[model samples]
Target chain A: MQIDWFTFGAQIVNFLILIGLLKRFLYGPILDAMDRRQASIRDRIAEAESKQEEAEQEAEKYRSLQSAFEAHRAERMQAVEEDAEARRHELLARAREDVEYLEAQWREAIERDRADFLHTVSERAVTETIQLTRRVLDDLADVDLEDQLVTVFLGHLQNPEDALAKKLIDAFEDADAEVTIRSAYELSDDQRERLLEVLEKRAGHSLTLSTVTDRELGLGVEVQVANRTVGWTIDQYIEQLLDEMLRQLEADLDQRLTADVSATGSMASVRHR
Target chain B: MEISPDQIVYWEWRFVTVNATLVYSWVVIVLLGAGAWFITRNLTVGPDISRWQNGLEVLVGQILTQIETTGLRHPKRYLPFIGTLFIFIVTCNILAVVPGYVAPTASVTTPIALAMCVFVAVPVYGIMNRGLKAYFKRYIRPTPLMLPFTIIGEISRTVALGIRLFGNMMSGNLIVAILLSLAPLLFPVAMQAFGLLIGVIQAYVFAVLALVYIASGARAHQNNGEPAPGDAEPSSAV
Candidate 1:
């Protein structure tokens, strides 16, 4: 068959157009869809990885907080136990000091009572003996018997203050004080009567003067009241010394306790973080 | 054996009459023209069409599908040339059987003209796609020294296309003609069957080569990342 050039060329053009149309409409969409789907899958995979990282960080944070809480609880428990031990020690020391004080006071009281009973017995015996002797030998017993009996009763009344003076002297043997009489020679009648009355009252018995002398004021009428002396003499110096020592010790203890409390508070704050 | 009183002058290059071949080529032109009109005016993506147009579509669609599979990076660009070549060659080939008709491809002029058109069109398409410098740079691979040989080789091969088709068809025609003239009826049928088979194969070979040539030419200029000839490695598209 013969093919004219014009007709052949035209046919060729038509076929070309058909092929181009099919490609543009159908094949192009398929390729574009395929590329888009690939990119989307990649994006999804990346997103999942990022989310997984965030989850892991959250889990780590939870674990860290739990461990920190446990450590803080352990620290607080230790502090509580230490505080309980210190309190126990403080109570034990206080109990021991109180028992020692009470024992000392009871011993001092028993000694004082024994001395008083002895002095009272001696006075009664001396008085009774003098009366018996006077009845037996009536002519020689008048003024001499009265003077001797007065001496004996006054000596008995003075014994308790003397014992108190000795106790004060022993206690102050290592301390600084001067023993002396504030007033000795010039006693008014009321002062003498009041002195006798107060001495008798403090000693727990009635007293008589051995002599009308003033030299015994060196002891300053030392007498016991409620396991303590109440006169202005050398014994008061020991009381002042003891009170100062106790006050200084208590102030030191207060400072230490304050420091401990402050330290514990700051430590607790550190543990909180 | 008888000499008639008046007769048309016969120009035979060996066994083919030049005038007869010319007349047959004209007839092919006319037939293709009518087919083109029937196709162009009524083109549709829908299913309804005359059997002729439908048949043409099926043929064109099948060839387009194959060309697309070459994974031609720019199948669209080369589609017109290759598609037209396919359709024209197929029509001319089948027309050889149209009683009292001869295939234009069975003549030298037609196949030569077709091969020349491809030879010219391919380079032109190549140059257009990639400017002149880049198009010429394609021949140097698998190395530069082979360029002279390759250029000559390409030209000869395209020329050989014309010679090959002309020789084969003319030989087949002559042999069948001699047989029919001798036997008057009996042996011509067998020879004609052989002619049809040869015609169809040559047509197919011509079309396929045209496709591959267009594919190669367009493909070379395609810096679009298609696998080179020996590198026809398949890959997932997406």
Candidate 2:
């Protein structure tokens, strides 16, 4: 081997220039592409994570809305039940008031009916008494015979408990003559003693006694003296009978009236438009 | 006594001496030593001075400027190796004109020594920058099938570097010496001038080739692969 400086120098310059060209053209493209790929992958991963978070937020919002809806529904149902319960209580209270009003009206009607019945019975009794007195006056119109009869009637009327005694007592009072009284029916021992005591005080035996069981007057004794007589019986009085019948009728009518009113009111309310 | 150009002078131990060539090699040594000293002394960053600094600045500036133009990060990394090559070669080529001075670079041994140093340095730097495994693997890269051929080519290139330098320098020295002895006056001057021109050309060529070798080795390790098909070219001259 021999040294060749000329050739070596020329070769070195040529190789240097060759290397400069190769570095510029080659390697640059490959490295640039690799760096770009790395950056894009990092960005893609970040985007994916953010999207996942957004999805989760949407799911949470939907869940919250569902829960709120359920709670609201439950609250509405509770309010409806409470309203129904209050209405039921109000209806029951109205029914109880209606019943009480009917009972009170029934009692008032019974009192009114009793008062009417009593008044009618008392008027009938007064009319019958006046008619009997008129007939006695007509029969006494003949003079001597009438006087004798009147004396007898007057004697009878002196003891007013008997019908005959009450007529004799009326005749004697009309003629202004004294009268003797007698009883057809036998008197009890206590009754005889009461009659004698009365006659002795009056200076005459002038009492008439009778047992009368009339349609109007039931059982017991009657006494007559002059134009006065005493009448007593065990039967119910007209006023008392009237009062009992009126009470029963009034109760029935009042009950019916009250029931009708209540029924009509209930039907009208149900039929309202 | 008659002597022929093909004759050899021998000593003990197989040492052969070429008398004129030995003197030329000495001339090469002195010129290199002096140039190195002159360039090193009074080195300054400032401008506006003697032609020596300006001349050096041009040469160094050209090398570094080319390195900058290549767009390498550290041009100074190759400065010592490349700069030494340029200076040593320029000194070796110009030393032929000095009386009783020999150009050592004209011998096979001197140029072989320089070439071997370059071969070792390329691999060492490759391994230092990369590693032994990486530097060695550069030969087999791109395709493993081409490993044997690439290895043979690299070895041949290194051997040729030594042979080429030795042959050119020796031939030129011989021709100049022969011409000066036969026609010592104006004819010799023409031949010497021819020698000087060729000498400068050889030095530039050697230094540029050195840069190529260094760039290839360093770049191979940097690439971690063989040169691509488009990047491949014939190795430079010896």
TM-score of each: 0.40, 0.40
- Candidate 2 to truth, TM: 0.40
Question: Compared with the true structure, what per-residue lDDT tens digits does model 2 show for residues B79-184?
Answer: 5566656556667677678764456567565566667767777787667667788778888777788789887877777777766776777787788778878888
User: Per-residue alpha-carbon lDDT of model 1 for A1-273, expressed as tens digits?
Assistant: 334343345334433443354344323333343345557777888999999999999999999999999999999999999999999988987776666556555654564465556545654565465545444543343334434433443354456566544454344344332222133234345544655653544444554533233444322233333344424432244446545655665565556556655555555445434
Interface quality of candidate 2 as DockQ: 0.04
lDDT of each: 0.56, 0.55
Runs with alpha carbons beyond 4 Å of true place in candidate 1: A1-273, B1-18, B43-49, B141-143, B221-227, B230-238
Worst 10 residues of 2 chain A by lDDT: A22-31
Model 1 chain B poorest 10 in a row by lDDT: B1-10
> Residues B22-68, candidate 1, lDDT per residue (tens digit)?
55544555555554554545444333546755565555556657778
Candidate 2, which segments miss by more than 4 Å at Cα? Answer: A1-273, B1-31, B44-47, B66-72, B180-185, B221-224, B228-238
State how far residue A101 of model 1 sits from its true place (Å): 99
